[model samples]
Target: MATGKKAKNVGKGMKGKVKETTGKAVGNESMEMKGKAEQAAADAKQAGQKAKDTMKH
Candidate 1:
């Protein structure tokens, strides 16, 4: 896997977690939902990268 891309996905996942936690603490349902979506997208991206790397090997 590309180190830069992998780091980006990890960063996105971390960012989403912060957003979700902050939103919940502040009672912002919309923000929380957005955070969850972001996390899911990051997870998917990471999975795709892993699969691609596996195929290459």
Candidate 2:
């Protein structure tokens, strides 16, 4: 289900944001970078889904 996938991705993005913030607060560069990458991947997936939905209509 597209809706379910979209909601999951949104949650992933929010989680990534939290990870990135916490890493920064703790001075952990690796965790920060990983979080950033996760956010980027989630964003890309969301964009792809949006395009697919647009095409469907």
**Judged by lDDT, which candidate is best?**
1
> Please, what are the lDDT tens digits per residue for candidate 2 over residues 22-55?
8999999988988898899899999999999899
Each model's lDDT: 0.96, 0.90
lDDT of 2: 0.90
lDDT of 1 by residue, 1-57 (tens): 899999999999999999999999999999999999999999999999999999999
Candidate 1 lDDT for residue 24? 100
Model 1, residue 17: distance off in Å is: 0.5
Per-residue lDDT value at 35 in model 2: 86
RMSD of each: 0.4, 1.2
Question: For candidate 1, which ten residues in a row score worst on lDDT?
Answer: 30-39
Candidate 1 lDDT for residue 3: 100
